[model samples]
Target: MSRTDFATIDWRGRPVRIECQWIDPERGAGTPLIVFLHEGLGSVAMWKDFPARVCEAAGARGLVFSRPAYGRSTPRAEDEIWDVDFMHRQAHEVLPALFTALKLGDEKPWLFGHSDGGSISLLYAARFPDKVEGLVVLAPHIFVEDKTVANIEIARTAYRTTDLPQKLGRYHDSADSAFWGWNRIWLHPPFRDWNIEAELGTIRCPVLAVQGIDDEYGTLAQIRDIAPRVAGICELLEIPECGHSPHRDQPDRVIVATASFITNNRRQTP
Candidate 1:
């Protein structure tokens, strides 16, 4: 496991500390760099060994980070309320600042994102076409779905009635901040219309979108819709007997597919 470090960046006019780690940092510059973006409730710790395993298999180095409000990074203010554009802010604002702080200037890294992270990856790629190499997204959401809202409602209930808070506490500094930051915005009434299909049309890099056949939060359409919108090569993988979190539900298959996608795409890139 790599040692976690903090990168301080100015966000919304204030300095925010982001927790990050580098996997296989000893690898030469010739090796591709894969940036792993965690899901809504995920953090650097939640990724476990998946990033390292993927980096090893694909002959790449990896970067894993915990977005603000999650993990040991800057926690959300007690009264902070994330709006519908929060993910957009993360992609367009926070990510770029972190890269600048880390001096990753001009290095077009491949992105591996899950769920909300996947959406952010797409937005970043769309907004900065020349700054990304490729993308591998798992259970990405291009638009809100009825099933997604329903599950989020269920999650809200579970957070209060079950041990979900305790489980999330293992990864976040303040479980309430992480939970409410993601939950409230997701369930916010206007968020139902949140969509990014048009933004995807601007992406010029290859994309490999994977989704589980049995995902409770969303259907295969989440990935299926991506194929037609992306301007570049878009591949879809539907894994059977999996759920929202494909990496957790079926790590071996997810790892193999992701590694193969990264390796093949790297070879094809000029």
Candidate 2:
């Protein structure tokens, strides 16, 4: 396991702490650097050894971080409520600040994002096309769907009635901050119209959009709609017997596909 480090940054006028880790300390400078973005309720610890394993397989350096209000990072203010553009703010504001704080320099990273992280990766690549080399998104939501809202509503129930809070507490410093921040924003009525598909047209980096055949949160159209909009190549991977989290459901397949995608893209990068 990689040691966690803290970086303080001013996000939207508030000083927030972010938790980050280096997955491969000995990777060569020439190797591509990958940034792993976790799911909505995921923290650096929730990702566990998956990032390290994938980095090892791809022979790349990896950086995994917990967003503000999640994991051991700064917790959300008690009265705070996330707006509809919460994901947009994270992509446009928080991530740039993180890159600056980490001093990653001019290295163009290949983003490996899952769920909400995948959406953020897409938004980031769209906004800063030159900073990203490629993308491998698992179960990304280009737009909100009915099924997604339904699942999120169910999650709300589970969080309220079940030991879900206690379970998430194992990974998050303040489970309510992580869970409610993501859950409420997603279930908010206006969030139904929150879509980033139009922004994707600006992305020139190669994209590999993965979705499970039986994803409860989204349907195949989530990735299918992405292929035609991006300026660069868009590859789709539809895995059978997989659910919302492809990395956990089909780790071997995801690792192999991602490794191959990164290698091929690296050779093509100028």
Candidate 3:
């Protein structure tokens, strides 16, 4: 694993520290940049070596970061409750600020996002059509579904009754902060109406959406719905015998498909 670093950016009128790391930096400036966005409860440490493996296969540079309230980055304030538009805020405000702090001016990156991160990538690409080259999203939610809610309920129970918190503590500095921040927002009654299907039409870059056939958190409709809505090329892949976390469950297939998709759809430079 690469050594982790901190990038401080101004967010919500306060300084937020983002935990980040680069994979295959030696691949040089001309190579494509793939930014890895973790799932709702994920952090930099939770991703393990998946980013590095993907970057190595794709011959691209990779950036893996833990958003606020995750990993070693700043934890959410105890009294804070994320609003319904939390994902939107991350896509529009936090991501851009991180880019600026990292000195990534005008560099349109390829986004590799999972779960909630996947939705954020779509939102960012839609909001800033010219700012992204391509996308690879895994088990992303376009709309809230009953299955999703049920699974989240199960997760809440597991977090309380099982050793889930201890396991998550291995990755996040404040497991409660990370878990509750994501859990409360997702399970919020108002969030049931949250959907990004209408906003996808604005995306101009090629998208590769992947989902596991046996994913317990969401169904195939999540990726299938993306095909007709996106303005640009969109491909869908369903892996058999896999769950929500494809990178962990079926790493080889996900890595190969992602690398190939990026290679095929990479923007041609003059």
| Candidate 1 off by > 4 Å | 267-270
Indicate which candidate wins on lDDT. Answer: 3
Error of 2 at 142 (Å): 0.6
Alpha-carbon TM-score of each model against the true structure = 0.97, 0.97, 0.98
lDDT of 3 by residue, 37-65 (tens): 99999999889889999998998999999
lDDT value, candidate 3, whole model: 0.94
Q: Residue 68's C-alpha lDDT in candidate 2?
A: 90
Ranking 1 against 3 by TM-score, winner: 3
The TM-score, computed over Cα atoms with residue i paired to residue i, of candidate 1 is 0.97
lDDT of 2: 0.92
Q: What is the C-alpha RMSD of each candidate to the true structure, in Å?
A: 1.4, 1.3, 1.0
Q: What is the lDDT of residue 131 in candidate 3?
A: 94
> What lDDT does each candidate get?
0.92, 0.92, 0.94
